[model samples]
Target: GGGKPLAPKNANNAAKNSLRVADIGAGTGNLSIMLLERGCEVVAVEPNDAMREIGISRTKDKNIKWVRATGLESGLEDSGFDWVTFGSSFNVMDRSQALKESHRLLKPQGYFSCMWNHRDLNDPIQEVAEEVILELVPNYTRGVRREDQRPVIEQHKDLFDTIIYIEEDFYFHQNIETYIAAWKSVKNPYWDLETSEGQELFDKIAYQMRHKLPSEFDIKYTTRCWSAKARN
Candidate 1:
């Protein structure tokens, strides 16, 4: 899970030609827009109203319909979509149940793909950021990845078969302030910069970077995707 989940690149020619999709846990509709750009009609399901609104406005995809729903109970009919995608939000979900729901939603032989933009901490600047973050919150754990739940999906082989992939590079560049803001903007459950302790740590990170780093930084990321072929 890295670099904007470049798994979308692996979309078969048929998916590119036309696809009807259910974008489960679609936060900010980033992936939905990507799908819409490919001429896919999408339904973006998100539980948080604020997050859903942000996604709806951000994507502005006419092909996308936003719905308030969680991954396990999407409030959508069965067998309606060719694909059910969990973009960057699969690990946090009750994935076993979510996968069952995805199976129910997808048409016969439909696809399920989960993707993540893994931080390219391998780079020096990114590594520095990681160091600062880990130093501040010793107990902070990165959210789970596909590997964490792959067994659950695999064990219940009647639902789907895992799709394998090779790592792909995805780069995004931003100024120092923008980078700081992005981290600050991370939601509360993930990391709460608004809290006193959190704010102090964030300030420390800001001070170090602002004093020591250049205005702009190039971030390298690795996008990983775990896809599956859904079964009845």
Candidate 2:
């Protein structure tokens, strides 16, 4: 049986009292769906055309407003949102500008939440996977390092007062195909490689992993969430 998925507890909490919420970089409306389910009016902002298409299709219920915009240019009204959230997309943003924009778009006491599912490098399989990616993929940018929380919070000290929550040992199970697809979706460096070479590396890695661990493949991740109310 598939394992139960872990949801962003912080985001869910923010949605409790929020009337209007914007999910920036909400690819395919993953987080947006949750907010909508919780009775918050959600706007799914994405810059990529394909991603926006996916989000639109996924959120056909007309409750979700899908907008093509980035963090720097959300195109929403100033002080228009009760909450703003970034789910696994904060690292792709210009930290200073995004924080400023987030603050600008929120009403007084509006909440801002950012969440990331971090791979636990302590696991042997996960460690080996990281090593393989670093070795095979050139100029790999590990997006955001695990240690970036302190500096990021410090940099935004004036925008909002911080509250940090960590959910450890969140388990995820994936079959080989699902694993490969999910990895390819978020791997920035792998996208740079030619299609043929990328496929080759992907196949090689999957083959090795299957041989190494034939049974159920499970990995643990730490879900880190930061939330704060906009400083008046």
Candidate 3:
């Protein structure tokens, strides 16, 4: 018999008044796909061409509508959505303006959900990975992008209420080769492959990965999920 994956999947029942969600700054449509699977009609607003293309190719569901728009200007209808969410990209946006837009697009009593899957840098393997990055990029700092959303969250506190924060640990296992490849695909890679300095740095990192890291290891992460209702 078939079964659910680690993430819960909801059956499609949109014909029967399913929830609607607008996933702003929906890079690669991961959040949109997940919400669509949960029986929500999702509008994925993205402004970047490369990311939008990948997201379009990855998600072909009828429930998902991809729009080339930023979080600050989603162009969604007023009070039309039951929820608005942002994944890892939230901290990168103008949070105050983003919240204002979120409030405008969501129905009263709807929720704004934000989450980040942060790597467990404290892990020895990850520690080494950071060291490798610093050795190469010299300025790679963990959580540099995430910083803190609290100030912005507070700045717009009047627009939302019933705030809640929850976190959980998750483990993803992969081979060293897969890990290396994944890192290479990361945006603004710590080491530039085209430059001689970057090549030298990558070579060093590669040597470490091949000789030191185990064939298979876990990449642990802490996922933080925060949700607040849209105030009337």
Among these predictions, the greatest TM-score belongs to: 1
Over 1-232, each residue of candidate 2 has an lDDT whose tens digit, in order, gives 2211233346556445546888999987878998887667888889878778988988896567988888789999989987889888877877778888999999877778788777888887677776666666656666673445546656777887755555556888877666665675573555533478777877776666665553557878887877777877
- lDDT (CA) for every model shown? 0.76, 0.74, 0.77
Question: Candidates 1 and 2: which is better by TM-score?
Answer: 1
lDDT of 1 by residue, 91-135 (tens): 777788888888899888788888877777678887777777777
User: Would you list the rank order by TM-score, best first?
Assistant: 1, 3, 2
Angstrom error at residue 224, model 2: 0.6
The segments of candidate 1 whose C-alpha lies over 4 angstroms from its true place after superposition are: 1-17, 146-149, 184-213
Candidate ranking under lDDT, highest first, comes to 3, 1, 2
For model 3, the superposed segments whose C-alpha errors exceed 4 Å read 1-12, 143-148, 177-212
Q: Which candidate wins on lDDT?
A: 3
Error of 1 at 107 (Å): 0.5
